[model samples]
Target: MDILVTGILLGGTYALIAMGLNLQYGVARIMNLANGEILVAGGYFAFIAYTATQLSPILTIFLVAPLAFALNSLIYRVMLQPLVNRAKSRGQLESDSILATFGLSFIGVGLMLSFFGGDYFSYSFMAVPVEVLGNTYGANRVLSFVMAVLICGALYLWLNRSRAGLSIRAIGTTPASARLVGIDVKALSAFTFALGGAVTAVGGALISTYLTLDASTGVVFTLKALIIVIMGGVGDVRGTIVAALLLGILETLVATLLDPGLTLAAAYVMFLGILLFRPQGLFGKKPT
Candidate 1:
């Protein structure tokens, strides 16, 4: 029963981690390999805020999310956009984005290391936990999970039910047409990447409080998110969330049943197995 609750909460956190990747790769189609770094940065940033201000992490996100978005925008503008704009090589656009994001990812991680040094820092705030059907635990973790769900739902509604969302979707499906119709793809791309970054920041703050973090700590998060993103289907927001939950629960179950060492390998094998049967993902549309 405890494992079940743990897995559910952890899965929601995983979904939070995946939201940024989904926005970047799934909706905007940017292969942002470095995005996981944003998670690291945001976590550290929240730690700093917590250490200094000693405020609740929920409040810390308000202080951090905007910074994350701004940093993400800067990263896209300075490091990534140029590659997309200047590349004349034979490689596809997505390939170039991946390479560029990889380069930037390394640079960002290195810069972070240079500045902060490698150290594990954690933050926590006990605002009191509400009993749910008799189970009692930290309210902060549960609050973080609920906030993650609400955030994802908000993002989904914005994409599916809002005008800006429609425009963004139109741009992704047919950029040339979108441009012909006067949609600013460049601006939209920046917005999309920033959106991803902002969400990652929230994820980072939540996860950092729940666990420990180092400068280069987001690698596992990145890998898990990437797997779930691919297995969920690129550009499918809903699919990403659903896949994250499924994978999170399954990973938890596997870790319990087998050795902890096999958890990653198991998830990898699961990804491969799913791909073999449904190459597009659980919610991805079949390619034409």
Candidate 2:
């Protein structure tokens, strides 16, 4: 029961980060390898705010989210937009963007290391424990999971019910068609990436309270999120959430029943098995 609860809460954090990656790669075709850095930056931002104000890091979400959005938007405008415009094919654009983001990741790592040094950062706030179904645990994980659900729910509603959401979906499905319909594809793309960054920041802030983090620490998370994104099918938000939950449960079970060191290996094995059997992912439609 403890493992089950922990896995669910942990999965929520993963889902939140994966959602951000989904928007960048699935919606905009930007293979942003630097996404993990953006996430960790958000944690650093929250830490700075907490240190200065002596407030709970949760309160810094509003500040960090927007900052992440702005930074990611700046990157897109200055470095990625030109590449997108010049690429002759979708494949070329994706390939070039991957390399560009890879370099950007290193830049982010360097900056973080230079300024923050190599030590792990953690907030000292204490969370009261909460009880559920005869299981009790720290409130921080519960809060993080709840927040993730709320954010994901709101995003789902926005995507399904709002005009802007429809535009985003349209662009994801058929960018050329969306452009023909008078949608400003470029502007919308920038907005989507900003939104992605903001979401990632929120997740980062939440997790910062739950785990130790450093500049280079986010790479593992980035890889995990990438796995979730691919497993859930690129750009498939709902599917990604489901995949995250399953992965989380699997990881928790493995960590408990076997050596914790094998958790990532278990996840990778699942990923490879999925790729071999269903490359389109569990919820994604088979590519034509």
Candidate 3:
């Protein structure tokens, strides 16, 4: 029971982390390697706000989200749009984006290192213990989980119920067809990319309340988000949520029953199994 509750809380946050990447890669068709950096940046914003202003990290989302969105939009316009225009094929664009964002990741790391130095940062917020199902857990973790649930739920509704969301889904499903139907694929892709960055930043703000993070820690999150996105299938929101929960449970079980150090290895093993057997993801339909 303890493991289940803990893992669910952890997976809820992971869902937020991966959802942003899914939006970027699934709809914008840009494989952003710097995604984790954006998340880390969001954490930094929360850390700064909490330390300087004594503001709650949860409330920092309003400030972080828009800032991330603007910066990400600028990055897309200045750095990625040219590649999108010049690429000869989807494969080429993806390859170019990988290289471009890989460089961007390094730049982000360097900037963070220069400003913040290489030290771990954490803050206490709602740090009291909360009992659930005969197990005690940190209140911050529970709060973060609740916030994640609300944000994800709202996002799901927007995607499924709104006209703009339908267009975004159409673009993700078939960009060419969406274009044929008069959707401005380029403009919408840029919006999706920026929105993805904002969502990822919000995830970071929530996570900073519970996790120790440093300038270089972003890469770890980047890889984790990548794994979750792939395992869930690109653009599949439901799959991402389910896969994140499964991963959380698996990691919790492994850490509790085996060695804590083996949790990451366990994740890799699962990822490998998914790639080998269900390359299209657990919920994703096989490509025709």
Q: TM-scores across all candidates?
A: 0.92, 0.97, 0.98
User: Model 2, 120-199: lDDT tens per residue?
Assistant: 99876556888988999788888888989998888988988999999998998999999999999999999999899889
- What is candidate 3's TM-score against the reference? 0.98
- Output the lDDT of residue 34, model 1: 81
lDDT of 2 at 24: 89
Give the root-mean-square deviation of each candidate in angstroms.
2.1, 1.2, 0.9
Question: Which candidate has the top score in lDDT?
Answer: 3
Please give the lDDT score for candidate 2.
Answer: 0.88
Local accuracy of candidate 1 as per-residue lDDT tens digits, 186-222: 8997899888989988898887777778888767778
Cα displacement (angstroms), candidate 2, residue 256, comes to: 1.8
lDDT of each: 0.81, 0.88, 0.94
The all-Cα superposition gives candidate 1 an RMSD in Å to the true structure of: 2.1
Q: On a 0 to 100 scale, what is the lDDT of residue 84 in model 1?
A: 67
- Work out how many backbone clashes candidate 3 has: 0
Per-prediction count of colliding residue pairs?
1, 0, 0
lDDT of 1: 0.81
